[model samples]
Target: MRRSVRSPYTIDLGQLHFSLQYNNWPIGYVESTNDNITIHSGENAIQFFGELQSISSESYNALSTVIQNFLTGQTSKIEVLAGPNATSYPLLAAGIVGLSLNVHMPPFSEQLIASLIFKSMSLIPSTNTRNVMLSASITIKINSPLGQQSPLNIQMMNMSVFLLYENDSVGMLSVYQAPVKQL
Candidate 1:
């Protein structure tokens, strides 16, 4: 007689870390909506909502200048990076769609809380899996007192949800496996 054997399988999820930079230097802490990322195959696209908090006054001023320029029809560029790949994209204030800035008064430790919404600027499909990574760099240029240019950069990194193509048999199987909901 022979005994049957069973093996367990595990899936490893991917993670992404995002931050803002100026001249290659990191700025304040960046926070996003969800801490854990999980993409369902059913989603066509995903949007990231986040806030940059506790930034220095100088950094805040620089960012404000960038936004001012963007609102005036000037294009700001943003740099995005993932692993070994990096790309730059132009951001228009009009494209931002929604924005809110809150400044703290003195004696309370000055801080700036900025709400930002970023849409799907572009997409890159993964060659190995159904996953995709979206990366871009945003550049903001401001004029100095002497009429020189000062540039501030914001970097973004995010991953797309797993693709569930309608023609994919595996995706169909997973869909059927989901528990039915009774109304």
Candidate 2:
């Protein structure tokens, strides 16, 4: 007579640990436990409700911090590791060890400057003239994650912008005082 047997290997998934980072800066962490985690097999999802203190520093003025707090508060990098119990399975630990992050940006459009020179633009066309004169002002905007809903402030500054085509300087955009805004 032949007997049937089944492998006892199984993973709880709740025994996994996740470390999240934003733009190479550590942000927060999530530890899954049997108590706070529930595995939904039918839905193919794992739900957990718990609290972990943020690991970011308050003194540092890094760009990651600004993006997380003010802008898009999303994890740009993630490191997955096996918990104490899950480490016993070498195969599972080997497969889940790495830093991987996926970010999907939706369609976005915004106007940087209302007018090119703060006035009407005039383009003159001449039959025999090959040289064209061009002047422009530039403004750089750093919008919050909330987009246009953030506060608005405008300031003016001077900067040099060059336009090149085919590795050759086609024109130069010289701005004496260009308006700059920060939110």
Candidate 3:
């Protein structure tokens, strides 16, 4: 299924430019398509933005929702496959590149959750540390007949910001702020 996520005021670490448009991600199918023939694509997509420290998928909707949502949306597309007498739909992804990085994620402690906000940043220069204002968050919905919803805790004990860097792109080592509040 197709899911939607909205990101407001995304930062461009390269040119230090702020994208004028708010980020919208239709990630999971919210109300329709209860099956799993899925596909999705995006530009400047924020699904997994930085070096993935930790990742997991609780539950997901069907494949058709992914295809239809992507086909009808601007950030994504759906492809139709035709054979002798059959038709198939799939989500299009140009290519896949894996990233590897070494990061220190300190365990969360009472001292850590003591506050309501935590901050984090990618490897950046000392000069740029003061300039790192980028942030990311997620909103999740639980699938059930009652239609319950809640934001899942994707953050670890350590409040680390997930930042993406292009191949050959490099930033300096700096301190980041990522605040977290216990629910």
Candidate 4:
């Protein structure tokens, strides 16, 4: 006779209390609307939404103007505040909050890769030259379930991205946004 192994025991807290702070200002708590920030706990996920003005109306307007100036190439960057009354974070313009995304890229077949390689090799001349040049096209498909369900019309803009580790800059990549049909 074999004895069945038991699963690990676990405890779930029905309700949890926590305080949220933005720019050092206490925004609000989860599932409560004392301030501008509002959070909702679902069966599988927790969602929250808030605006920059929620922290402080004065800071919001000031940051908005600063953002406008920066976008117009007037200012290099907006200032960051980190004092007892600080309410500003760098690169945080007026926008929505609590946005989440799940993106994935599916694998392609080897046949497609072989076809692209042959087409690219056709560009090279069949001569006794050591140096030859060739070019190939690469297709990258990005999928997001939440994005597909969104009803709002979205337009992506060109932006520069910098990868950093431990607050130190590592590398940069320039991204150009374009529209693609969902497949």
Candidate 5:
């Protein structure tokens, strides 16, 4: 008679500790099928946006907040105030518009996404991680080729973002830059 036997080797921590999170924005960007569009090939995007006028639009603030929170896995305690116009707050302002962090969680990996920059400077974060996702709303302050009159407004409002981060034991800065790949 042959009997089935069991050989067991198990990791016994009894009480395991881990965090589970699933988050995303419903009213987010819808991707355009066109891949021929060029993105951020200009001189300096960060600086470029700075020169442009800013709006008191909560859209930009919300977008920035989501990005910072998602990347850092933390909540922002301050209440961000919106202005009457887009140019009210400088592109770069005195206060920290979004939350920042320094994380050092192990098992680090990065995912790169291709996205386009809109005239209004909002970015639609790509969908990747199971927990966190971001959506952007753009408001153009200037009347130009990329404004509402121009159909390019929608196309310009696209962006790609890195979407995974584990809280480091000794959190200093939340891992933000996933790095842009070079051709």
Candidate 6:
């Protein structure tokens, strides 16, 4: 006879909350994966995938601004705080160090249907905060096409920030307005 076992770790997206400008956008679904084999090479990683339906243009605009700021080497970050925690983690430490985004936009629609994909790695020798900071590279994909043209693809790199975790949820925080540089 053979013995079988099941992993005890799991995440419920329903309990997860993601926000921009204090406005919470309802997430339709979330999917995540962990790669244990990569651990041997010192690259143990987990990937999160999700979709947000019926997002307003205003909300999407806010998201676009944040992405643009980070990509331009400006001081930009996204705050993430998991369940019941008052502390929100700021992604991208200082001077663009730990994150990336890929955006996809669909063509011809009354409202914008966007797909965002974020990817990043865990920070080595973690931080001392109550939350854990991950070295992450995120990709936001917008599925909207451009007037009979193909969809748009944008990539941003090097965002350093902390990721707070509580039970099984996560959150992100960043500057809502563009920061003015002082000389």
lDDT of each: 0.34, 0.44, 0.27, 0.34, 0.28, 0.36
lDDT of 5 by residue, 1-183 (tens): 111223343211111111111122111221112222122333311111111111334545554554455344554332212222212234322232332222222221222122444434333444774333333332333323233454322222323434345743431222233233222
Which portions of model 1 miss their true places by more than 4 Å? 1-17, 25-32, 40-44, 80-183
Cα displacement (Å) at residue 95, model 2: 1.8
Candidate 4's residue-wise lDDT over 116-150, tens digit each? 12223224544886433433333434333224464
Candidate with more favorable, higher lDDT: 3 or 5: 5
Candidate 1 lDDT over residue span 69-129, tens digit each = 4445454343222221111211322333233222221121112222333433465668998
What does each candidate score in C-alpha RMSD?
28.8, 13.2, 20.8, 17.6, 27.6, 24.8
TM-score of each: 0.28, 0.32, 0.17, 0.20, 0.16, 0.25
Model 6 Cα lDDT, one tens digit per residue, 34-142: 2221122222243444543436776576556554554444443333324331112223122232222222322233234344444555554435754444444444444
Candidates 2 and 3, the one with greater TM-score: 2
Counting only residues 3 or more apart in sequence or on different chains, how many pairs clash (N, Cα, C under 3 Å) in candidate 3? 32
> By the TM-score metric, which is better: model 1 or model 5?
1
Model 3: worst 10 consecutive residues (lDDT sum): 14-23
Candidate 5 lands at a TM-score of 0.16
- The clash count of every prediction, one per candidate, is 10, 1, 32, 0, 14, 43
For the record, the alpha-carbon RMSD of candidate 6 to the native fold, in angstroms, is 24.8
Q: Which one is best on lDDT? A: 2
Q: Can you write out model 2's per-residue Cα lDDT over 10-68, one digit (the tens) per residue?
A: 33433545544444554444544443333333333443223223454641333344344
Question: Any runs in candidate 3 off by more than 4 Å, and if so which?
Answer: 2-74, 80-150, 157-181
In candidate 6, which residue ranges exceed 4 Å CA deviation?
1-31, 34-44, 50-54, 81-183
All candidates in order of lDDT, best leading: 2, 6, 4, 1, 5, 3
